[model samples]
Target: MEPAPGLALVVVSPRVAPGLMSRSAWQVVEAASVRLCADADEPLAVAVTDADLPIQVYAAGSPALLARHLVERAADDNVVWLGSADGDEGLSDAIADEVSRLNDPPPVEVVVGSWDVPGARLLDVVAVMDRLRSPGGCPWDAEQTHESLLPYLEEEAGEYAEAVRSGDRAHMAEELGDVLLQVAFHARVAEDHPGQPFDIDDVAGGLVDKLVRRHPHVFADVEVSTPEEVAANWQKIKEEEKARRPGAH
Candidate 1:
């Protein structure tokens, strides 16, 4: 007799763009006899249907009910469950409980469809800063100007320096985060500037451009024997960059 069909639970990161999924995720989801999700409007669900695959939108009930339904369905048909961005709270444990009650439960696997890349959390920081400055968010955050935030930025920098001096790794990380928050806050404030406006991406992009341009030893063929040589090369690059700027003498 053929082995019973199994269930594939596909989890995707909200940080990642929709429709971009791992090969394994696509394969399992494509091979499944039935695709299920709680919401038809979810990015993953929409992506799946956009690819011409059929997906059923079930009314989201309690975790236990959903788990029981999934296991029962998977007993006869291969099933793919597109998990919610918030992780379908407690659903996995409920599924485990339901599976344990059966004499012969279908095999279940969790497939990671998309994962956060390095620096993905920085996106969250930007999002939070936007929220804090928006109309309905914190009044203090919404009212803060770049000039008003300068003192806090300086204070945070000092705290970070002290953290480094004390050799407290945890404190250093926390202080560094505070410094980053100031950067985000200032960027958000800049968005409201009447004369000139720029977001965090602009700030980050400029920094990235400068880093790539200055680091010849790392990014280009320039060779440096020692730290002093690297510094001298950096200074030379800085002067060259200054000269090339529109207003440079």
Candidate 2:
């Protein structure tokens, strides 16, 4: 007798663009006899339908009912469940409970479609800053200006320094996050500058350029073995950068 078809639950990261899934995820999604999702308007679901694949969107219901439906459907044909970005809360446990009752349950697998890359959470910080400054967002955040935020910036920096002095790693991390919030807030305020508009990306890009330019030992052909030599190289790069400035003599 032929074995029962399996079910593949595909989970994707909201940080990643829709339809950009892993090879294994695409394979299971393409091979599945039935594709299911809770919402038709979800990013992944829209992407799947845009690719001309037939996917059925079930109305919002209880997790147990969804789990039962998935298991029953998987008995005869392969099934693919496109998980939501916020995660299909409680659905996995429900499925586990449903399968446990079956004497001969079909195999079930969770396929990771996409994952967040390093520093991906920084995007979330930027997004939050944007929302806070936008209309209908926080009134205080919207009203903040770079000049007005200077006191906050100084306070956060002082707190971070105190955290470092106390040798408290957790406090240092929290204080560092506060410092980062000040940076994001200033960048958001900068966006409204009429003549010199700049965002967080511009701030990051400049920092990236400066770091690459100074780190010749890592990025370029320059060779430096000792920390002293690296420091010397950094100072030399800084001097060169200063000399290249518009008003530098």
Stretches of candidate 2 exceeding 4 Å from the true structure: 1-4
For residue 148, give model 1's deviation from the true position in Å: 1.4
List, residue by residue over 1-249, the lDDT tens digit for candidate 2.
333498889999889997999988887888888999999998999988998999998755888999999998899888889998779999999999999999999899999999999989998999898998999899999988888999999999999999999999999999999999999999989999999999898999999999999999999999989999999999998999999999999
Candidate 1: tens digits of C-alpha lDDT, residues 125-218: 9988899999899999988888899999999999999999999999999999999999999999999999999989899999999998889889
Off by over 4 Å in 1: 1-4, 243-249
- Give one clash count per candidate, in the order shown: 0, 0
Task: Kindly report which residue pairs in candidate 1 clash with one another.
Answer: none
Ten contiguous residues with the weakest lDDT in model 1 = 1-10
